[model samples]
Target: MISHTSISTVASIIQLSVAPVFLLAGIAGILNVLAARLARIVDRARSLEMDVPTADAEVQRAEIRELAILDRRMTMCHWAIGLCTFAALLVCVVVMVLFVAVLSALNFAVPVSLLFIGAMVSVTLGLLLFLGEVTIATRWVRVSEQFVLKGKPLYDR
Candidate 1:
């Protein structure tokens, strides 16, 4: 049986954990987006690879350039995912430390604060990496460039 004091402590910990739980939710959302982007990139690369044998020289050259860009963006996205995952893990640690400190009457103020700060920095870096990947994606050849059947050159109509 849990004592009233223990119940109160647990309640307080739950309350404190709310913010980190929300952070975890946001990280999960980021992970979802990164994962979907990665899947699409990989799928496109594989499809292009399959068609390479039959592609004309110009199309093959364009595909090669696109593949290289995709590879770079893929690497950046992977780094973003890793850093965000680390941030989420740190948030989990912060929550656990908060509970432990509260229940044991220990002063973990510095550790908790530092962990939260590190998590924030990690999240920031991860977001920057994601931004870099997305910005580079604009240079990828578009459908307009590929078809180019009835457009006024697309550069200076």
Candidate 2:
């Protein structure tokens, strides 16, 4: 009993819902990049500390201070990225739910039903990405410990 206009309206709603999801995805991408850069900077600092002469205590202390700052910054970046990733995932879930609810309410055709299925798949992918980020972040502490406390190169045996 749903009219053509009602189906079109539902389609528009689906499109509107997509905007926030896309925005969150963009934010998540930026955060991912920031987190990567922070990690790299921390790694470089660790390597520099290793190469510095051991006899120069004052210089070594200064380098250690710098490394500590970089470590704190990297930790902050990791947390920020994690928070943004979780937020993006929540936004994606909300959009998917809204899309499915609207399409079902309007009793749309096969294509709209397929679109809802696709949205669910997208939600699943988002959740996977979020989980991956968390896993990487958890391992970061181990990586930092190896580089700083153990003074081991990342690729060393």
Candidate 3:
């Protein structure tokens, strides 16, 4: 029951979706990076938790502070991963709607445009959260505190 016009329409929709498919691939790469970061954060936090129980009072205090920062970083990473996942899902929906629009012979320009915009917004938010975490991780880092002698770090002295 499929007509020639219908076949061509389907082909056209596939062609249109090629770019979005590539976009999905790119998002997958970003998601991989975000997930790996989250895993590393979780691993570090777990290790710290194990060490804190056996440490002296001062070390325990320091460990607790470090753990708090790690907790914040993990939270940010979780948000970043969540937003990126939402973005990828939205992109998938956009591709599906594109196909439906073509098959149904209906205008979905507005919906397509809105969905693409939403995906971009989600990606932006995710990257922003990741950047915030990196900033926090680096801002209070002390390179010399752990490597010091003669009032200078060994590496820099």
Residue range 34-129, candidate 3, lDDT tens digits: 888889889988999999999999999999999999999999999998998899999999999999988787999999999999999999999999
Candidate 2 local distance difference test against the native? 0.63
Tell how far residue 115 is off in model 3, in angstroms: 1.0
Ranking by lDDT: 3, 1, 2
Candidate 1: residue pairs that collide: none
TM-score of each: 0.86, 0.55, 0.88
The Cα error of candidate 3 at residue 49, in Å, is 0.6
Ranking by TM-score: 3, 1, 2
- The models' CA-based lDDT, in order, is 0.90, 0.63, 0.91
Error at 80, model 3, angstroms: 0.6
lDDT tens per residue, model 2, 1-157? 9999888978888787777767667766766676676678678777867856663878877777667766666665566556566556656665665667676774444654454455445545544554654555565445555555467576674
Model 2: lDDT of residue 86: 58
Alpha-carbon error at 138 in model 2, in Å?
27
Model 2 residue 93 CA deviation (Å) reads 0.8
